[model samples]
Target: MQKTYKVQDDEPERSILARLITPDQNPGDDPLEELHGLATTAGTDVVDELVQRRSSADHSTYMGKGKVEELRLMVQKHDADLIVFDNDLTPAQIRNLEKATGAKVIDRTELILDIFAAGARTHESRLAVELAQLEYSLPRLKRMWTHLSRQAMGVGMRGPGEKQLEVDRRLAQKRISDLKAELKQVEERRERQVSARKEAPTVSLVGYTNAGKSTLMNALTDANVLAQDKLFATLDTRTRRWNLPGWGTVLLSDTVGFIRDLPHSLVASFKSTLEETRQADLLLHVADASSPTVFDQIAAVYAVLKELGIEEKDTLLVLNKIDAIHNPAILNRVLDRYPNAIPVSARSNKGLGCLIEAVGEALGREFLDIAVEVAPSDGKLLGYLSSKGEVLSREFGDESTIVHVRMPAGAMGPVHKSALSIKPSTLMDEAKAAEEASANSSEVA
Candidate 1:
């Protein structure tokens, strides 16, 4: 079995972390936060660290010669077996770095792929992870196959054959094609499943990893999903029926968390998994408000959502882990920027009711404000109106009672069948009339 992702039986691999910070890649106060977390998650000991600040990266190698020399010395001093870069490196750059530093090297994307490849639990998720790994490594396969060419300055193995490399490339290309076809079918199946569940509104939970999404999921729906304090803990999507108090049930989904600069190939490969986000009626963008770089993490999640073409979806920003924030000023600042964001503590069950209410209000945007006229003595129909929909106001007449109600767009058909007259009404009119009635009652007092 492939067990490299977990630490070897003897000990954890000692790795020297290298990060080249360019002007555009401002990784906030902690430049190594993502990389350090990833390395720890992948079970590696950080023996040493090196950070190189540059306006532009060197084309030959990401780090400059001086920094490379410094890194080489650090590796020897620590006896590090591996080097992991915080930035994604091209195949040539990886080769150059390995040659310069004399250690195994991997980039940010490669590390992420490693985690996904290992953490993927379900068969479908495993396929997605494998496809991502294949797509990412295919471009770098040429360097890997050079040994098989048997190109030596001797008699029989004098010149390069190009036979082995070509064969491997062809095999890889064919596998990529087959994986795409299989995943395409998976995507189609996922779409059909989504279409079949059209009667239930879907609210997908998306955010940076370890943002308490699964905790909130368990709190809301008691789904019992694995909610660990780690990056990409829940890769496979899980959906649970969340019972909105006043509103009916809704399908709440928890998906794979997003990280800053997520590998493009991984995103492309998980189309079937991401389809849930796309098909969602609303997105609950959860964030770790307790983190110092909360805004940066939130922005990164948005970037991934935009990359997936769901940036404009109706999204509700949820500031989770409020219990962890000791400073009131910080929470106020988060709320100041996102005035409408709901702050909650999924662990303690604080503010979840407010979040539920907010979700109900957001989902209510799809409801139709309909004026239904029925007989004053019709107790059965009046009971249905209050139970199935929010009754805005009612005008009583000797013969008929006109009731203004807000009901889901899909539920209008059944509601209309029982009423004497049904038609769309501007919801604003009901609000204004209700306000007038309230004022009149106060004036009467």
Candidate 2:
């Protein structure tokens, strides 16, 4: 029989210190700093950090007995109430650590889940977070029965503890099923909305958390999304119409940000929201231009995108927060590394025109230059074309109006269905016609 350990819930504002054990092969990659940031965002003050280099984690304790003892001393020295591990711990490991250290123990996954739980604002996000929490807590249910373990020593009481565990597991399983069913309905509704917007181009902002994606989204489309200098500040998917000059209105969306070692359960639960990224015509892979680990952050984001099977999608590397960098050489170095990256400061609106131009250029590739003739009385078609495309010239005749416009290839379905004469035009022909008309006008003058 395993020893049962009780975990005392600390005050909400208790101080926490994190621990990390890096493998021998990966000595340089430390996630403690990021974990500290997560702790701060979760409203806990980090008192100190402890790191150990080991060939591998101990199966039962996550770290060797010596390291656990060292951690216990550090916790006492720092007067920390909670200990956060940079890696996920098994149920037994958690229990063992709690009993050994006599402190509340949590792992990276639980920390992130707590952040998500606090930041979840919408019905969908709240349900997603709840479902993820339930899924994560399911396998760890045995730890919850630690108090009852002592009472189950007698034969008659032994079965009740096991039976209660089974009952709780069944209830959790049922709740998980119900949540999945509800989320499925929400996803179906979202899919219908996506289907209706198929004619418009969509661009989604995706990047590591706190990479200024929300700020960029607000800058690009004037969306009032909550933009804070904190991780996972925005969880709800926000879509707004972005009017690109010379191109047309595009549906731009800002999604929940990704992070290093993002929990699998959270990923699974947020798949519906992240599907917006997968369905986008273009992905703005935003990165923090000022962070020293910008490249690593980019890699982490790409890893998540790859998991979503959207790695090969058309992506524009948007290096944001350039204003925070003092040295031009640093920005140049980043640009040299990613030669095609668009550098911008979302807060100050620097280089926004170039960003928009790049977006227009990417979206413009899908447009077609066509000429159409419609009756002047057909204001609906004219308004639709003017709103959805760039009308180069509009000529009014006695019977009809000839309008040359550049529109998305897919958007022509409605124009064809309408009673309008449409034909494809070449750029060279349009240029020559304009030049010849200008020459004739000069000769007449």
Candidate 3:
């Protein structure tokens, strides 16, 4: 038998802070700073932070008993209402810490979920967040219902609290199933949309959170997506058409940014949104070149990519935020390590031309050149051709208008069925002729 807590609609703003330390199992970034950032993003006033050097977390509470006592003192001093831990806690640990400190307890995973719940804007994102929240809550139900007193069972009398707990658990499981079914419908629709875009190449931007991906997307396609400096600022995937000089129009998408130790539930729930990256023809692995942990961030992104089973996808490393970097040697070192990496500042519009050229070169290798003749009266066909490809040349004749264009192989399907006279272009004649001439001269010599 456990107590059932009533859900509140609107809670007052409260001061929150965190206690963290380097995990003995895996050494990585000091999560206290990131947790503080998350708390701030969730609109909670972070009053203070505490860190401890421990080989491992205490079994009952996340911190040692002495550390927990010290934390209680800090909570009292700062008048904090919430105690956020940098590590995920077991249900028992959460309950014990709350009772010991007399404050609300939240872990890193819950903090991330809260931020996502606040930032989810679109229907799809909302569904994904809801599903993740339900899954996360399912295992912690016992803790939430622990406050209720148990009734003694005798003869025909049975405790009703256990039945209520069962009912609540079943309801949560049902809601999770419903959300999944709805998400499946949305994913099917998304798959159809993706199928429609198969004629065009897709480039997906992926990187650590706050790595300037949205800024780069806006710069490249003028998409005007919500570009902010905060972590996970944009959760919805946005796609826009980008025209390359030689590659025609390609799709560029900005997706939710990846973070270190991104919750497994979130990754699973957001698969539909992340499918944009998985199905992309190319991935732009963007990183903040100015951050000291740039490499670590890059590794984190790759870890998520690996989890998504897209680690082997064709990826172009894009080192962004060079405008904020003062040291040229840092850029040199990064470039030296990643020989094919491209350095660009999305904010200042620096080195963007090179980035575009690189993308064009990668995509252009898959395109074909074709020569076609269209009637001058058929402006519709002419416009379609121009929109779908790069028109190399145009000539007007009495009977028809001749046009040479470069387009992707996938786009040739519709042109083949049209009335327009189309043929593979002999545009390689000049290069072939030059090669033959050079060979003849060398043989004569």
Candidate 4:
């Protein structure tokens, strides 16, 4: 008989056990449940969850020494290879926790960064995520990696064999710098593209993550952006031409979704992409009508926008996902809750027409109608009026052309002094001029 030796599986997948540590007067429930969603996104199986309530976290242990011992027992009971902290843990705390529990530990911020890295699709997005990760890791490189990696033949320590901490740190630093350089190039390209849209009206979608902003974008502009039932599905800014019937064409951009307590490192890294919202002429604040904490999410988005200095922009609250509502009573409740909100089902493309019309009304500029007798010798003035203002009717009479024009409110003062008479146009000449421009552009292209 031939002797057979069975090879044991060396690289076992890591199992994570998570717990929340709340300061005094904790919120209703541990927000760590949301962290579980993040963990799922990171491809980790959460075996169990624990919450420790104390006046404050222990400076050395994050949780008290007694609680840390209890966490050790809990990790052993669950056979979990990793422990996730609901809140951010300091480098010192991370090292000390590892020494106590003998389980690899990561904090909420690191967990979020890992998810971002996994979800980043495009080269630009990956560069942004990697840059943020590096920036976050830079401050916490205090031998925590050394302590975490000092494992002896265990399932959780299935990393490279005997790799020094300094080597990993040096390699990570180089990659971080490389990613920053790549992202700077990407940012420059994006800025040039945005500068070209300075003359056109730009509308941006802003909302909490997975609030159906992408779905709304798809419904309005036929943009086939990926809209998944997951968080942070979009990282890069996606802008497209939105042609409206009465209001002309405005550039609409969908950008990265916002979440509560988004990492500061991410905010700093993704500032350029979020500038799409900052520079918007109008903001479509999409909200999840189905979420229980919808109000909180809305507040969170506004908080970030306020910090970004765009909270004062004209914003329309769009209560989306009406298809999920069943009872008319509940629908009435929601409608009553947000009296000025528009309810729509982006998935089914319902109530989008009203949304477009609402957008048109929000971008509405005051209209002016005037008749000007331009000397035939000054044909340039008539042509300028046709392009800058709207020419309703023009009749050549003798040596002058009697022209009717409608212009924006800002144009009224100058055009009125130059015109023979001023009145409201029976026909909206401005709308007509906009239509003609669109048709002409289409024909040329």
What are the TM-scores, per candidate, against the unseen true structure?
0.80, 0.78, 0.78, 0.71
Model 4 Cα lDDT, one tens digit per residue, 1-445:
9999998966433545455445543344445656767777777778777677777778898787777888888778877788888788888998898888888899888888988888878777777787888888876765545545455755666545335555768888898878777777777777666644544577899999889999999988998988898888888889888897798888899989888778887876787787677657678999888776677788889988887777877789998988998866766776787788888899998888889889898877434566666777876677657755556788787866778876545434445556544445544366568899999999999
What would the per-residue lDDT of candidate 3 be over residues 1-445, giving only the tens digit for each residue?
Answer: 9999998847544655655565553334654666767888888877777777787778898788887887788788877788888778998999988888878898989989999999999999999999999999998987776767656767545456666777899999999999999998888788657645645788899999999999999999988888988989989899999886777888999999998889999998898888788767778999999877777788999999999998977788999999998989988878888889999999999999999999988776656787877888888778767755778998788988878888655456567766368766784456547899999999999
lDDT of 2: 0.84
Model 1 agreement with the true structure over 1-445: per-residue lDDT tens digits: 8656655577889998999987876577877877899998988999888999999899988899999999899889999989999988899999998899999999999999999988999878998998898888888987786555466555555445456666778998999999999999999999778755745678999999989999999999988989898888989889999888888999999999998889988888888998888878789999999988898889999999888987988899999999998989999999999999999999999999899999999998867788888888778898777655678899888898888887655445556677888867765467668999999999999
Off by over 4 Å in 3: 1-16, 22-31, 151-160, 366-445
Better of 2 and 4 by lDDT: 2
**Residue-level lDDT tens digits of model 2 in 1-445:** 9999999977555555555555543323554778888999998977767777777888888888997898788778877788888888999999999998888999999999999999998999999999999999999998888776445455566655677888999999999999999998888777656645644788899999999998998898888778999999989888888888887788999999999889878887887887677667788999999887787788889988888877877789999999999999989989999999999999999999999999988876767888787887998899778755778987788998878888766457678877468877665467659999999999999
Model 4 ranges off by over 4 Å: 1-30, 144-185, 198-200, 327-338, 365-445
- Of models 1 and 3, which has the larger TM-score? 1
Clashes of 1: 0
| Model 2 regions more than 4 Å off | 1-12, 24-31, 150-157, 366-445
lDDT at position 96, candidate 3:
89
- Window of ten residues with lowest summed lDDT in model 3: 22-31
TM-score sort, best first: 1, 2, 3, 4
Which is superior by lDDT, 1 or 2?
Answer: 1
